[model samples]
Target: MLIHPEEILETINMVTHEHLDIRTVTMGINLRGCSHPDVATFNENIYSRIMRCAENLVRTTEDIQSLYGIPIINKRISVTPIAIVAESCQVDDYCSVAETLDRAAQQAGIDFIGGFSALVQKGMTPGDLKLINSIPQALATTKKVCSSVNVATTKAGINMDAVAMMGHIIKQTAELTRDRAGIGCAKLVIFANAPDDNPFMAGAFHGIGEPDCVINVGVSGPGVVNSAVRALQNPSLGDISECIKKTAFKITRMGEMVGKEVARRLNAQFGVLDLSLAPTPAVGDSVAAILEAMGLESCGTHGTTAALALLNDAVKKGGAMASSSVGGLSGAFIPVSEDEGMIRAVQRGSLSLDKLEAMTCVCSVGLDMIAVPGDTSPATISAIIADEMAIGMINKKTTAVRIIPAPGTKVGDMVEFGGLLGTAPVMPVHNFSSETFIARGGRIPAPIQSLTN
Candidate 1:
């Protein structure tokens, strides 16, 4: 993991001008040992264990940032899913668990703490149900805590019951946090085929198969990729793809260096380097802009999907070549609110909900950071999750939905969530009803592709 000084010097301009940086350095801490029968004891065990493990995470990241002269945007922690860790506790409500995690994260000086989660892809246990029921309150009460629920998987198919419940849970979370334009929903994600080593927030959790302590990194370089593409004058499609692959290789190498240094300092195992092109609100640093640079007039146009597929494949191939430990959702991300270019596309009516859904088939994650109207029905939201879940289940890829039913907002209105969360223009969903469709709560069997064995 030791990089040469010349290699460090080579990335000076990319760091100084092109917005290439380690998006997140997440420490995964297994909390299975913290489980206890008493609720108070369980909380105490988790809080003490997390504090002991992650007390120096922020400072270590800061030291690495100063030593390497590379910006690390976020230092985060992912614990074993609370549904599994807290099942032994006697408590019915998990809001206290969420608050404990939030306090520990604040005390440790980290950005966010994930693992307020449940895995109910096949069927819900009593503990899973308890954790799921507490999500609305947990997210509403905790600022730095993030939650996710995996309601479907490639092997287990789609769980329509959990899907239906999550729709209602999302609505309730929005209502509880209406003052902030339902920002609580922004911290919640519904997933299908969630990865074990993802470092990004709102969908990150330490999986059961992971080590007791591990370090994972997420790298983003949309601006660098865009610059590479724009540097080529009247290039063919093959030329653009090659340029992206080279740029992605450089970006992933930098990320691996950062991740390994952080792991070494913290005395933790280096897990994986996620080379997802996660964009921000900043101008010129957008995945959508990269697509547009490939000759698309707008992001969600006719040829947009084909362009995105090329970008996604090239990024994966290049990143895989750069690092042997590449994992997570290592592809392009199409989060609407987080990308300024995506916001502009939606504002110009060039991007619609249907188009975004179509693009998710090739993208890293699915239906990310999209805002819909307050009056949208839970059934419609469930239908949306179902569609995204089906895509993941059939394709055997990780997909997720992080949609916000912004309270009191309609189409064309903007809900501003400053700093990384960014602003979202309310996109319109279909007006048709899906009540009966959602009401038939049963498992959608796994696709034929799942029979790989």
Candidate 2:
């Protein structure tokens, strides 16, 4: 990849003005080898392995950031799901392991470490149940550990039992951290069809098939894409899509270069370049702004989904052309709290829980960073997860929910989770109950499309 002077200048402009940056460079470490029959030994093994593998992760990323003058917002690590690695241990509680992970991450100067996770898309093992049970305590105690559970997949159908369990778990997590406005739940996510190479947080994990250690990069440039769309005047929808595609191509190329360099310096394999238009709370750097620039008065209005569909599709197409290693959730993200435009839309009544759910059908992820009334029932949360899972299962795409039921907060109330998590307004759910539906806890069979394989 030869760099021309003009291309360099354009990239600098994007970084300096448009908020283009590598969102995260996650180091995935396989912890399958760290399992042991003794819980104490198991903890020691994982702690030692992480310290050895990621000893220089932070320094290496910092060096690269300085060299290229590109912002790398987070340096993280993803390990094999704890349920798989800790199943061999005798102890039932995995909170101890979560603490060990937190220590390793902090000592190594990492921002966050993912893979405190379990994959129960089909069914839960005894170990999975144990880890799931420990999530509330683990998250409430740890500062940098993130947990995710995959309760449904296109091949395995929906595990309604796990879905129901997570509702209660999330509630417990919130109550335990009520002083912080349920910030712990912000670090936990429930997913359907979770990806192995995702570098983003609250939902990233190292899959069974991944290498021992690899570097995966998540590139975010919603501002650049928004600029491209707004630059076109009196253009057709096709023209808007073409502009997004071209912008995505440049972003992907830059991301791949940075990822490969980071991997090379650390002596790790370069995994994938995720071209997700992840947004921050900053103005002019939002996915919702991109949609509004396409001529909509506000996000979540009619034709919002269609605009999102165009954006997601064009992003994927352009990213695919730029690199064979385009993986993870490579499309536009619509986390309401994280995007300033989305926050405004919610406050102004242009966005709602139902509208966000519908938008998830075409976006990369589902119903992310949402806040609901503290009194919302656990069964209702399960039903919300079930609904998002169904969309991902049917479409064979990745969808997740990171909702906060802030204690003592109601609709129209604001919950502040500063930094990358951002603040969210409490959104309303349906008046009717989904308790009866969620109470019938069993696996929802896979769709007919699963028969293809």
Candidate 3:
């Protein structure tokens, strides 16, 4: 894992000028072993387990960052999905468990802790129902806890019942934290065909198949990609794509090297490297800017989906060449709020809900970090989610939605979340009712694509 002297300088340039950084070095801890029927006992075991496992996570990440002169932006933890672990406990509310996770994350000095979640792609169990009900209070009260629910899978099909419930849950979560601009909704996601080893927030959780403990890395370099694109002078489409691939190869190599070092220091198994060019609020560090750099007038304008398809495919191909193990949501994330270019596009009236939905077909996550009107009906939200889930289920790709129904907000108003969450402009939803469609609560059978031998 020796980096050449010249490669070190290139890495330095990527960090200093292009904002290249390791987005997260997430440690996944399985809590299945700690499950207990008693709520209080389960809470104690959960807290102690996380604290003991991730006590040195922050310090170790800092040491590695200083050693490599690379900025590691977030140190995080993703545990086994809470719904599964809490199923044994006879609890009416899983809010206490969420509090335990928050406290453990705070004690360990991690930025965020994921896995206050359930998978109801087929149907809901008593514990899954309880955890879903607790999401509103859990997100509102916890400082750094994140929740996700998988309501659809390619094999199990679309769970209309779960999808319908999530719409109400999302709105309630937003309403509960309306004072903070409905920030709670930013920490919750609904997914279809969700990946198990994702290290990104709002959708990250250690799957049942994962080992007891592991280290997963999420690498980000939107700015680097932007810079690479900018350096090109009137290049053709094929030339530009090749340039992106080379840049991605180098970025993924650095991520793999850093991930191995972190896993070794923590005595944990190295899992996967997520090569998602996740955008930020910063000017140059945006996925939309990269798209614009490819000659698009705006991110949501015509040809945006085709451009995203190219970028997503190139990054995956290049990263695959650099690392033996690459998984998770490995693509460009086009979250409107998180990406400055996308926010500008929305503000200018070029990006609409429909166009964003179209882009999600090729992007990382669906309807991510979007803000809708407070008056938006729960059934409409469910319908929106159903559309997105159907896309993923049919295509056999991961798709997720994290929409914020900011209370008392309209299409033009802006809600500033600051930091990484950024500010969101409330976008208008279609004024049509889909109540009847959502009321048909049952499983939408799996797509024919799922019958792969």
Candidate 4:
């Protein structure tokens, strides 16, 4: 853990000048004990269990932050998917449970609460169906609630029905809260082979196999990485690998320290340290900046994929060197609104949805922060999700889509979600129809690699 004086100066400069800080250090708490056959009993069990499990999360996180002097930007909780506990309840009962969970998060002083989720990678259970149906209302009515749906997997392929339903649900969710439709989308994520113990949102949840309680840290420093790249920008330089390598090393060290301290304070096992360079609306804290530093004027350009590929690789290598356990989507993110560089790129017409999709092949997630016509057909959105999931299934990498269809807004209109969720200018989609392709409601067959002789 010894850092040289020069390296320390560089790190300090990165943090002070750039917007470098740990995005979140989430503690995952399994809530299986909250299950009960009786609806009322189950509801009570859920509130009590979450309250007991997460009661110390905020305090423990604060203590660790004080001891380490490194900012743990978010003290968060992820629990077992509510769908699992609401099996016996009606749809209305599920919404009630969401309200209770939201209240518990507020009471516990947490900014966000995750795991209002359903896993329908293969097929939807009755409870799963009910929960999915209630997501729009639940999300609109409740504050601080996040939701995720896993509709695809490497072995099972994509569930078109579930995908289609989610498309309509996302639109309905937006319609229910037109002013904050994008906020619901910001809180919602659709995944292929989603992980249970991911400390990143809005997809994080305590996996069933994990212990009852454990601490996981998601350390972000896109600003740090971008600074290193900027230092190497001599205008005459050809390759930027060295800058990426060095920056990743420092970023991983920060993650390692934060993860260990949080785990120690909680008296829980230290889970993976996710070295994701997540961004905020603040200046200089951008994945797009890292890309621009690599000589691309904008992130969605042809060179963007090459830039992200190197960044993603260097991050994994450096994080792996710093910690034995490094998981989560430990790569760069290109969310349009969250990063100022990305927003400008979109405004200038330098970034497009198609180019963003290309970047996602090498980056962390897919089509994040993208906006389309408010009246865009549900089937079209489903097609987009299916296309992204198909990439993850074939490549066997974790990829997700978080798209917002701003209600009553058309292309070129801006929709603001406020706070860290930020504002996104509506982007255009292809007017060309994909109705026939999307309407063919069947699963995309598993990738060829799935067959084992």
- Model 3 over residues 10-69: C-alpha lDDT tens digits? 778899989999999999999998899999999999899888888988999999999988
- For model 1, how does the per-residue alpha-carbon lDDT over 1-453 read when each residue is reduced to its tens digit? 899887666588788888889999999999999999898899999999999999999999999999988899999999999999999888888999999999999999999999999999999988899999999999999999999999999999999999999999999999999999999999999999999889998999999999999999999999999988999999999999999999999999989999999999899999999999999898989999999999999999999999999999999999999999999999999999999999999999999999999999998999999999999999999999999999999989999999999999999999998899999999999999999999999999888888889
Encode model 4's per-residue lDDT on 1-453: one tens digit a residue: 787998777666766787666778787877787777777777688778778777888887788777755677887888888888678664454788888889889988888888899988888999899889989888888888888999898888888888888889888887887876556777889998787668888888777788887888888887777777787647443346656666777777887787787777667788878888888888878888888988887777778888788888877777777777788788787788788888888888889888888888887877787778888888888888988998888887778988988877887787787877777889987787777877787788788866755
lDDT for each candidate structure: 0.95, 0.94, 0.93, 0.81
Instruction: Assess the local accuracy of residue 219 in candidate 1 as a C-alpha lDDT between 0 and 100.
Output: 97
Select the stronger candidate by TM-score from 2 and 4.
2
**Model 3 bad stretches (over 4 Å):** 1-8
Number of the top candidate by lDDT?
A: 1
Candidate 3: clashing pairs of residues: none
Give the TM-score of each candidate: 0.98, 0.98, 0.98, 0.95
State which candidate, 3 or 4, has the greater TM-score.
Answer: 3
> Which residue ranges in model 2 land beyond 4 Å of their true spot?
1-6
Candidate order by lDDT, decreasing, is 1, 2, 3, 4
